[model samples]
Each structure stands twice: as C-alpha cells, then as structure tokens.
Target: MTIGGHLEELYGLPAFTFPGPGETPRELPEPDAVAWRITADSYDAEEQWTEAFARFCSAVDTTRVRALAVGAWEDAYDRGPGDIIEALVTARDRLPGLRSLFLGDMHSEECEISWINQTDVTPLLSAYPALEEFGVRGGQGLRFPALRHDALRTLIVETGGLPVEVVRGIGASELPALENLDLWLGTSWYGADSEAADLEPVLSGARLPRLRYLALRNSEIQDEIAAAVASAPVVARLEVLDLSMGTLGDDGAAALLGGQPLTHLRKLDLHHNYLSEPLLRRLRETLGSAGVELDLDRDDADWDEDDDGTVHRYVAVGE
Candidate 1:
C-alpha cells in the first residue's frame, strides 16, 4: 500500500484521549489518520475532503496529534491557492497541539500569489503557540508572519522561488528561543546582485540570540555577502552552520570560514559550490585548525538526496 493509504488506516482507529476538562478522545484508526492528504480532483471531491477535514479537526483531540503534513498534487489544477491556505489555516487553528507542520508540493494552483495576499497567516501562527518545527516546500513569495512562539526552534523553507529578504526577516528576536534555521532558495535567486541585502536587517536586529544551527541551501551568493553573513554579530554564538548550494567559491568560502566568530560551532556544511581542490583543502585545513566538523557536498553527487543519502557527509577538518 502507499504511504497515504497507510496514514488513512492510522486515522481510522479510535480516538486518543488525554487528561483534561472534558472526555479524552481516542486516536483515530489507521484508515482516517491521513486526513492531511486532500486530493481535490473534482468539485465533489474537494467539498467532501474539506468537510471531512473540518469534522476530523473538531472531533479529534488535537493534544494527541503531534505532526501535520499537507500534500498537494503537481497536476491537480482544480483547486485555487485560497482554498488550500484557508484549509491549512483552519486546520492549524483547530489543531493547537501541532508541533510540526510540513507543506509539501506547494506549487499547486492553491498556493498562488492571490492566495498569499488574501490569507492572514498571523492568526494561524498565533494559534500554534507551541509549534516547534515548520517546513515549507515547493512554493514561492511566502511572507513571514510575526511569530510569537517561545517554543519555536526550527524553521525550514525549501522552495525555488522564496525570496532572500523573507528568510532574513526571521530575526532572533522574532523567535527569541530559536535554535535551528534551514533555508533553501530557488535557482532564480542566482541572478540577483543584492542577494544578501535582505539578511542584513535581521543580522542587525536582536534576532536569534540563542541560534545554534543555520543552513542556507541553493542560493546564489557572492563572497562579500557570505563574509557579511559569517561576520554577523547575531551568529557569534552559533554551533552549527550549513551553506549547501550557496554558490560560494573558494574566495567566498574562505572569507566566510575565516571571518566567522563562531567559537562554539561544531558543524559546518558547504555543498554544491565552485570549490576547487585547493580551496576545499584550504577550507578543510582552516576549519580543522579551529576544531569544527565540516560537512562538505561537492558537485559530484545529486543534491536532492534523502536523509540516508550522502548529500551531507561529515569530514574531520582538524586533528
């Protein structure tokens, strides 16, 4: 059976309850567990899916649900962006216990520009005050909502069209307790001259005071910008840094690695850039001397590998 099928089976089980003011609901059976997958090929299907989702949200004890995954088909063209955003916002508000939210195949017609302009993401963010990790995939032009969650720690944006400014706007203060940040920009960002301009504002602000892990993937950044990002005051306390697919050449990579004030950093990722053998050697030597673990992904392999893949392999730089 498919993953969706298995999730559906999980949702069909009895409701899971907890100790609260009212009766604790039991967990759903297997068949109904995958309520997040709404394949709206036809009007009837769309209506039925929405209705089922609403009912599930209202009946299921959200405190028992831990993760939420929203998937959209690449060819499903019937639904609009507003429909998906509305549905997602509804579910987010209803599921207060949600700790992780994954937005998959986000390029569907349901995630168009108009949908973003119309959707009020602030309320949805406000609802999930306990959210810990958020992942957005396959969409562009998504604005950041002013998040006030003390529990938020990880924010991952994986899209080709997401702007740099949006990523930088997520300051440490915005997530006072934030620790990990993962950003994957699209190929379109490579042509921009001021790619790192957006990040300056957040770096100057009191954002991410306690940030430890940071990842910047698939962005077209120059040496100067990379240096600036590395030298940013807020990042001085970082323990992990990932710059996969950032197009940082030897000079840029060297600048960033050499200029970084991250004394406690333990892990560093530099993948899919124009690093020659000499530059790679230099990076290894420099970071090794600093006692940091380097995770390097040369251009020899495909970058879209799974967790078990070799996209990120640890290399000891120093003795």
Candidate 2:
C-alpha cells in the first residue's frame, strides 16, 4: 500500500489521548497503549508547556508507547518547532518503544500545511534508531543529513516546495529496510529546484531494494517525471505507482500509457491532472482492463497564454 494508505489506517484507529491543560480528565487514558498524541498547543500559555509535558511523561509509561504524534507544538510563529524535538530528545530514554512518529499534524488554523517551517530532522533518526515509520509535513528549511538506518521501513516527506538537495540526500542515504517512500515535489515557485535527473538513483532502482510503493506527486514537471518513471527499472518491482496531484497533460499521460506494461502494477493514481476526456476514457479502458485501480479524478483547467502567447500549465499545490 502507499504511505497515504498507511496514514489513512493510522487515522482510522482509535487513539489514547494525553490530556491538555483545560480538558476535563487531566490524565493519560491508557499509558500502555500503542497510539498516542501530544498536542502542546492545548496548554494555556507557552510558560505552562514544560510542566504540562512533565505531567504527561509522568502519566504515561513512555517505554511501552509505540506510535507518538507531535502536533501544533509552538504555534507557527515559533522557531520552526525545534523545541518539540528537543523535548523528545531529552526524554528519549523514556520512549524506547517508539517506532512510528508523525510530526507536524497541525490543522490549517494552527498553521497552513505548507507554511509549517521545519529544520534539520537528522537528529531524530539518530536519537531513535529503531524508528520504522517517519512522516513529516512542510519543507521550508528542511534538511536530512547523511543517514544510515537499519529499521526504517516508511519515509514520507510532504511539502509545497521540496529542494533538489533533499531528494539527492534521500537517494544518498542507506536505508536497508525502506519499503515505502513518498515525496511531494511541489512547484518551482516555492523551492522545487530539482529536475527529473535528480531522481536517477531511485529511478534506476540502485538505492532501495525493498521499495514497493513510490509516490512522486504534486509536481510541476510531471511530464518529465512520468517519462523517466515509465522507462525506469524500478517500475518492474513497484506495486503502486502514484503520479497524482500534478500538471500531467496529454503528452505525459501518453508517455505513461505507451512506455510500460501496466499489467504488473496493482494500482495507478493520476488524479488531479490535465488529461482530456478522450485520453481519460482510453486510460480507463486500458488500465482498467489490466485490473489496475485507476484514480483520474480532476480534469485540468483550460490553459492560458501569456502576452507572448506562450502556454503555461500548473500543479495542484505549491503556494
């Protein structure tokens, strides 16, 4: 399944809540539970944060907790939510059972998904070496230092504008157990400097052997990416190939349809693209006949020409 599928599973499961400041029951419902969330914004003021967290630590048997969520830590105005990371690091020993962590689960009211600035999260991996699933939202100031992990299975980075260096860094990393990898390569206007060539390591299938689900969604240059992916050796092993939420026009869709054998893939997501109805009907017949679950939700808006009559296309999310 895709990371999106896994996250949906996580969201559906019931969670054990860590009581906030003004909540009725100020306690941990199940200290030994598998899923839990720490919403620091519940505290009345920033001054009460430390003490509230201390109480949370005291209530829960941290050593037995498996999945922990860090959400709405220090508001959007704060310094990139680094303080929450520090707190987790300080209490690292207490959370030895932590395997899955979801960072930046704040709503739009707390912080717009794209506006949530994040710094280098390399330290988190070093601190929790056994962590298997790591999900982070936002891309501003985000950096993943040289990493070598043995237990990490799923790595997800959601962003409005991901840098090329970050993609290169992921490709350069040594992740022996990685199975699912999702990267939202947003518009160039934000910070998407990387081209399709930058993803050569992943496309060549030289870096990750266990990878099965790969998502290169939300991109401006979806056509180039689609062409590269269709010819890449990695597609031979991938069960789900997601090229959703992009500006994939007829040319890109045609490249994908003509380049590879779609019978092997279990599912293909091309929702929110610029394919015409004729192309969509063709895709539905071809891919559906191959028994692939296809997602072709949004039709693109009509293209507009600049003063020089140059046509321009756009991706789903960037700003």
Candidate 3:
C-alpha cells in the first residue's frame, strides 16, 4: 500500500481505495464515490491513445465520480498540465457533482513523490466550483493562486518542498467554508520558503472560521512551527493539529506540552520526530488523560553531530 493509503487508514479518513490492474472496480452508488486511477502504462502497444483518457471519462458516470484520483499521469505522452486537466475541464458539464480530487496518487514505484511534476491548479477551482476537497501530492512547479471557492471544505498540498508563493496564495485565498488545511512545508532546497509569518493568517483563528483540522507538517523547521502553533489562537478551535513527519524536537514538544489548552482537541499527530523518550511518555499520559489521541509512533534517527557535538535534525520525507 502507498504511504497515502496507510496514512488514510491510520487517520481514518473517508478515502475511496482503488483496485489493482485487472481487478473489478469497487461498486459506488449515489452519494458515495469512486476513484479512477489513470496510468499511461495501461495502454496497449498497438492501441492509439487519442481517446485514452476519454475512455475513462466515458466509462465512469462523471456525475457519480465524486473523488477522482490521478496516478502516473506523468508518463502520459507530451506530459504537461493540459493532458488530463484539459480532458476534465472539457468534461466539466458532465461532472457537475464531482466534489473531491486527488492528484499525483502514485507511490514510489510509479513516480517518486518529489518528482511528480505539477502546474498551476487554480484552473481546477474555476472548472469545478462544487469541489469540496482537493489534494495534490507533488510540489515541483506547483502553483495555486488565491481564489475564492465557496464550497471547498478541504485543501491539501503535499510537497517535498512547498514554495512560499504557494503559501502566500493559500493565505490570500477566500475559502469561506474551508474545514481542513494540510500543508507539507518541505525542505528549503525544494523551494520551501514559508516561515511562521507566511502562516500567520491561518494561525490567527480568524481567516477560516470553520477550520477544525490543521496540519503544518513535513517541515525542516517543525520546531519553529511548533513554537508558533503552540501560541496560535486557532489551536483552541481546531479539533486535530498535526505536526508530524518533521524535525520537531524537545524544544518544540516542550512548547506544545507546557502551552496550549489542548484538552478539547481530538488528536495530535507527532509521528517521526525528535522527541525524547521521557517527553513522549509525559505527552502520552497528558494527552491520553485529556482524551486526545496522540501519535508519537516513530522516533527520529540518532541526531547528527559534528566534532564539536553540535546536533542536527532533518525534515522527514524532504529528501
């Protein structure tokens, strides 16, 4: 299974799993959704692909295709934004009811998460105003300008290095009904320039009044982010706060432990971090007593030290 699938299972997300090649697709009735995993490898050698994507579009009742997952589209001929995106946009009239979309749904076997090329996705919001949930896995060349989409409830941008421009765009967006926001602030080498200042709007607790889940995760600067999130006014209203898959260390964990009134939160995910054993134990006891599910499942590798004993940490999944 893919990391995404595993994470969905772990978090109990309402995800629609896809079938393997040649397996029968899942039966999806009204209100429920089905995911179409497209791959260039599916085409036969002698077959013409001029109608390749079109076949999938025609096969599925687009109206019933609420959750569309794109996988290995990068291998499609003349790889660019226009390939599958154009097909979808042209079929928008037939997909009026489509709500959720997941792009770059391939695991490392198909394409490494960091290598999945993406373009500006703001056009999707314009094409599908009814879209409630949208997720993109890769960050390379990804761009999402600030745009108003009233029905959008969830926006997830997973990147090895999310650009600051994208961060600013999200902050400037007018998602009145946004409920869940997850941004993987990857390593600086991958163009992740967003700092605490760029995230101020989200942390203010005023921008998206309906927000309940916030994940500022997969960051090289998780400790700094943790310090900021510890005091963010939004924490009081959030149901789940994830700072996992990062370099959150003792200082960051201390900030979260000693600060924040997290008794009301439903879950706190701090997996794959640099938290010490004692701190993790204390955190478990504290959050457990408060009825908050804590995930400190994976500890960081032994800290990197130089001759002088200066320690260093790395952001999980940034490489």
Candidate 4:
C-alpha cells in the first residue's frame, strides 16, 4: 500500500460546515488550525514494522502534507535499532513537501540513534531536503550530520548527555541557512571546567549568519560567551532570543539584555534561570523603551495565563 492509501485508511475526509441563519457553529477552522499532528509507533503485531512504515509512507500524498511528526512509543525500545531507523528513513525519504519534522521521545540506551558517536543516523537527515523546521526532544547525546542543507531554516535539538563541544561543532558546520536555533545543553553545567571551555570556540566564531532566533536552554554558558553573543553583528538581525535555564545570574542577564543592538527583536525568553525581579524589570524596561516585544517566563501564576491566551503572542519567543 502507498502513503495515500494509508492516509485514507487512517483518516477520513474532514467535516465541514457552512453558516446558516439562526444556527450556532460549534467549531470553526481558525487561522491557528493549520497545525497537524501525527503519532506512529512500531507497526502491528502481525506485520513487519519496516514494511508497514514503507506502506504508510507510500500511501501519504507528500505534496499536501506540510508538517509531519515521527514519534516512537514505549514499544519502540523492544524493536531492533536498525528497524527503527529504516522506518524513519522511509518517511523522511517519501515526504518531499514536509516543512516540519518533529522527532520526539526516541529512547535508546546504547546511543545507537541519538548519540554523536553512533553516526548511523546521519543518512536519515538526507530525506528532509525541503524541511524548514526540525525538532528532536528527549534523546541522548544528540548529534548532526556533517552534510549541510540549504532548505533548513529552524533547528531545535534538546537532548541529555550531549557534550557542549559536540553541540557547538555541529552548529558551526551544519545549518548554514538556519534562521532559528534552539539548543539545550543537558549535561554541561557551569561548574564543569571541561564543558565550559569546549563551547568557547564556537561562540566566538561567525558561524550563524542568517540566524535570527536563538535559544540556549539548560546550558552552561558563562558571562563572556553571553557578552560575545550579544555583541555579535549577526545578533543585530535577531528577532527572538532565549537564554533560559543557564547559570546566567543577574549580572550575566543584565549584560546580555543591556547590550542587545537588535531593535527588531520581537520576543525574548528568559525562563527558569537566575533572573530576579529587578533584573526582569530592567529587561522589560529595555524592551519596552525600545519598542521591542518581550516574553519573560515568570514564576507568577499569571504568566501561564498570558502564555495560553494567544499563539505567537510574542513572535520571537516560545516553542
């Protein structure tokens, strides 16, 4: 079976409604309704997983499928690593029109899929020639392929146990056309001397020329690197900036937020870090005075309310 047939079998034609006099509509396809979500686990018990995935890919009409999410369920751990990779490769190869590819919750104890040392997963990225947005979450030691693709605009890599050097090296070499970069350094902490020093070279380099949105979450970035990032000429074009969950205290935050030359920045995310109210107030004042938008992740309960109120509330911040 082809991908189109598989989609037909999986989902039916979407229901539609028209306006009627004195009739109230329960739902409407709002502007934000453009998002689509797909979840696929290992295939059925009687069928081979790779064959099923191939059939699923063949059935889908990639020309119309704009956003795709490939996720492994808890049962994915029971399957062989090779089979998992094959299934993923099939989807990526077939989905030519995919703009976003979200790889979520890939569990591998041996680092076969997620670790930088594995290197087997490099070929999987080749299928996404047109992919503009890519996100990987809850993996271990996430790495990138050396091959660079010009179509990719946004890349988000969040993983555990990944060396900061490996992350920086990958960022420097790959993703030349990248505009948005969200990197979460899990194992590298500020107190660790080795990891802190490893990231210095990449931070100083002029790698990301087109990068407009940057998020460094849960990383061990020092004040010097933060200052470098703020001073980078490329940062002047940035529209969104996120440095949350780092060891940056009030001083580091002040230095970064104070020296931002980018007046085009529409959103800034500084959540769950070492920012106090005074510092937050200063950030807000800076952004407000410059007519730049801000999205400060606050501990106050009211913050969440504002978060849920609108999509793209602050253009440069959030997921």
Candidate 5:
C-alpha cells in the first residue's frame, strides 16, 4: 500500500525476499513467477549483497526467472547501483526470461527514498531488450539515457523527488509498446526540478501510442501538471488517469473538468489531495454520472490551510 517501500507484488508475481545468512527461505509455489528480492543485512555491510546475488544465481535457474527486485545494497545511502547493474548485465545471457525489473526496493528502514543513490539505468533496458516492465524507486542520482525499448509495456518511477534529467530522459526516449507510465513527481525540496515544458513529448503522445494508464502522482505542482494534462493528447487515449497524492486543490480540479471530457476514461484517481467538499461533490456529480471510477480521497483537506491566511500544499513524500 505504500510507495517507495517494498512492493508486495509486481507484474502478477508475489514478492519473495531471498534468505540472508541465518534467515530461513520460505517455500515458493511458482518459483519462476516469483519476484525475487536480494539485499544486504545492514547498510554498512560490505560485499554482502553481491554475495547474496551470486548465491541466488547459483541456486535458482535464472533462465526461468521473470522478475527481479533489488533491495538495499551495502551502504545504499553512500554506494550506488552501478556494480549491481553490471552484475545483472553480466548475467543477461543466463536470464533469458527476465521481463520485469525493479531497482532500489529499499524502504525507510534501510534508506529514505530521497537518500537512496542511483545511476544511469539505460544499460538494463539496453541489455534486456525483451523486458516488458521496468521500475525503480528513489530519484537521487537516477539517470535514464536516451534509448528506445520496443517491448517495454510498463515503467514506474517512485521517488520522493524526481530529478529533471530523468523526467526529460523519459520524455525523449521512445517506448513504442509502453502501455503504463507511473511517475511519483515528488516535491522540489529534495530534487524535483521538472517543469511542465519538460513533459511535452510525453504529453504529446508522439512516441507512446499504446499508453493507456498514466499516473503523475505525489507532486507539489499537481495543479500545473493537471492543467498541462488537461490539454495533453495522451489523455484522450488513456483508459486511466491518476493524479493522486498531491497538492491538488479546486483550481486543478476545475481545470480538469473544464479542459477535457474525461467521461471516456475508465478511472480517475485523485486521492490524498486537498480539494474542498463542494469540489469533491461536483467531481462526483460530473464523473459519477458517466460511470467513470472517480477517487477523491482528501485526507489532507484540512491540513492545507495554515494558522495564518497562507496555505501549505505538499506532496505525500517529502523526505
């Protein structure tokens, strides 16, 4: 249920964390479909993750492996994912069936989402051409070089603060078969410096023809993003549009209602927002009549208004 945390499942695969030195390994029903996670015990533990990865590769028939979820690497706050990525790339020939990959699966206990260091992940997509789904959490030092992956269907980037380079890289890159793109555009307090112009390519739907589900969640500038997405060519073809977990207020909701006809969408998720009761009622009255599944969970409604006349709109994840 939590973003930037350990995923319960991915691509229809139940998550299975690999056993550590003294830990017990549970019995896996469908081993091939299991989303195997590898991690080091402590952040400062040296060379443990590589050892665990090696042990996993030796024990499991990786040729049948479909999903890989990389948990905390040794000293994840200091060390980056370069070595781990190379190790996976080295075993690409062995992992002929790998389709789904998730990097930086550590939760707050290991490292804060914004503190997790990452690097250019273009190699993973380049090496594994047949990959259908690729996801990564944490945006610090994260990079996605310009590249096209024909078979990729789903791409999810969950970050406390998504960097501008990554956002532009995503827009510039070509994903012909991509159907779902979920981005948690967290606040700029960490590193999110992306503006509306950066998403022009993505919003234009110039390259992503198959994209049906688009989520621009967990943002501080949710209203601006909503206004942009209102006129986005991609929205017309999308089956689901998610703008949840943001600082979205009445302005964003009004822009959405006024700009586009969202009756064609299968669902609209605007949960964890700061909308007023009247706006929520209007959204329900409008979208509900069209049979569109509308989610207007506004737990932050009262929290936005400060003691003074000022308002404090914020995203779900700031740390």
Candidate 6:
C-alpha cells in the first residue's frame, strides 16, 4: 500500500492547509491550535511553495503557530528542499512556538517515495532547537549529519529507501530527550545501504537516553535487524518495538524469542512480513500468554513459492 493521504493531525493539532494561489484560507479559532500546512497546488505548478509560504506567513500570526507541515514543493521530484529549508530557517524567529514540523509530505501520486529529492535537513534541527517532534519523508538525495540536540522528543523519517549515512548519522547523534524514533529502512534495490551493524549505536542507547519506542520498518534485511534488535541493550528499555513492513520470517522471530524475554515489552509489531503459520501460531500462543501485544497480521500469503530453502521476500514500501 502507498501513502494514501495527508496527515489528518500532527503534534496533537489538526492539520489546516493554506489555500493555493487564487484560493482562500479558512478562518481558524486559534492559529496555534492548528498545524499550518504550506504546499503548492501541484508538482509542476507555476505558483511555487515560496509564494504559498509567503502568503501563509503574511496571512497568519506566525508566532502563535505551533505546528507546521511543508508538503510538495514545485518539481519536488527533481529539486531538493534547499530554498525551502533556508526560508524556514530565516523565519525561525517568527515561528518561536513551532514545536512540530513535517517536511516532504507528498504521496506517491505527486512524487514516489524513492523520487523526492531531499537535502541535508540538519540545518532545521539546529535552527529549530526547541522543536519537540520532526518528521521527514523520502530518501532520494537525503543527507543527515550527527549532531547534538536536547529538546527533540520524537523523530520520524519515512522513505522508500533509507541510505546508510543517514542511519549512521542518527545512530551517532546525541538526542537526550528523544523518546520515540521511527526509521523506514526500505529495500536496498532502491538505495537502502545499511546493515545491522549500522544500527549498533542506536541499539546501544548511548546517545538517546530517553528513547522508549523504536521502529525499524521496511527493510530487505529485516531478519538481520531483528536478530540485532533481539539482544540489543536498547530493547530492554523500549515499550514498543516495531519491526513491521519488511521481510521478517521464522528466523527473525526465533531470534526474538530466543535472545530476550519480550514479556517486558508492551507491544511488538511484526505486520506485513513473510512469517509462516506455525511461527505465527507460536507467537500468538507464547506472547498472548505473556500479555505482550503482538501484531503478526498480513504475513504475505504467497511467501512459499520455493521449497529449495531459498526465500523470496519483499518490503512493504520501496520504489
């Protein structure tokens, strides 16, 4: 399944889209209570995001705006968000109350997840130091560097293929207050280039002390990820551990059941995987009794085309 729609709500605030060129924005009870969205009408629209952003800033009280969603820019499939990022950074003082920001919220219709060209978004983190939640989509031309930040509590990066440098950057970065982290490590066929070793720092929890939830979804190497995560020091502290939308099989599930006693975890999500029925039954029988909320749904129905011990699996989202 593809990303079908825009976010209904973000940071506990309803998303309010600022109208495109020649359109009118609706009246809001409080600008601060809504997540203001600034996006162009289309990918190749003559009216670019710069104009839309300028209009939003002029029409709304920026200081009171607490959340922002920057959707598809003009030619987002080909262009990086350098100019848009600069604009947001330049206007940082005007958005002092902005606590949540989502960059590149385009669905596959406008730009496929593997096609949106992104740039180094590290500047946003440094500029919006007070931001509590940050979400980014797409991975093509994406770049993230390791840095220190104290106030960020949630970080989400969704992509059809997440590169290694970005993953390693996050693993090495210092995020003391980060409680939730989600990384969609899509298939390598589209440029996902990280191994389980790349996740070592994050699994150690050395840099992210307050991390309580960790989701490593959509990977060609889901079993390796599961094996690494099974005994990782960070798993002991996480309330929710998600290894969904990937190629998980009985091998990975076995590692999870063997390495650590997951009774302490509140939830374990393994949806959209390639696990067999026996393992699924075993999981339900075992975790069900332990009160661990397990999600083993949508285990692909056609997972066994070969009996030669060679497995064929696919990730949920990839270009």
Which 10-residue window of candidate 6 scores lowest in summed lDDT?
Answer: 299-308
Best by lDDT: 6
> Per-residue alpha-carbon lDDT of model 6 for 170-261, expressed as tens digits?
99999999999999999888789999999999999999889999999988899999999988999889999999999888999988888878
Q: Provide the TM-score for each candidate, comma-separated.
A: 0.68, 0.89, 0.85, 0.65, 0.95, 0.96
The alpha-carbon RMSD values of the candidates against the true structure, listed in the order shown, are 9.5, 3.6, 3.9, 11.1, 1.8, 1.7
Better of 1 and 6 by lDDT: 6
Candidate 4 at 89: error in angstroms? 3.2
Model 3 has an lDDT value of 0.75
lDDT over C-alpha atoms for residue 290 of model 3: 79
lDDT per residue for candidate 2 within 1-319, as digits (tens), equals: 1122113223234455467767787534554444676666622355344566677788777787788766666555345767777777788899898888877666555665566788888778889999998888777878886589889999998887898889998988888898999999987887888999999988877778899999999888999999888789989999999999888888888888899787788999998888888889989888888799998888543356899988777666665
Off by over 4 Å in 3: 1-33, 42-51, 75-79, 300-303
lDDT of 3 by residue, 275-304 (tens): 888988889888878799988877454358
lDDT of 1: 0.53
Index of the highest-TM-score prediction: 6
Q: At residue 307, what lDDT does model 6 achieve?
A: 75
- Per-model CA lDDT versus the true structure: 0.53, 0.78, 0.75, 0.51, 0.88, 0.89
Residue-pair clashes per prediction, in order, are: 34, 0, 0, 7, 1, 0
Instruction: Rank candidates by TM-score, best first.
Output: 6, 5, 2, 3, 1, 4
Candidate 2 root-mean-square deviation in Å = 3.6
Off by over 4 Å in 5: 1-5, 24-30, 300-307
Flag the better candidate by lDDT, 2 or 4. Answer: 2
Order the candidates by lDDT, highest first: 6, 5, 2, 3, 1, 4
lDDT of candidate 4 vs native?
A: 0.51
RMSD, candidate 4, Å? 11.1
- The residue-by-residue lDDT of candidate 5 on 183-296, one tens digit each, is 999989989999878888999999999999999989888999999999999999999999998889889998999987999999999998888888888899999888999988
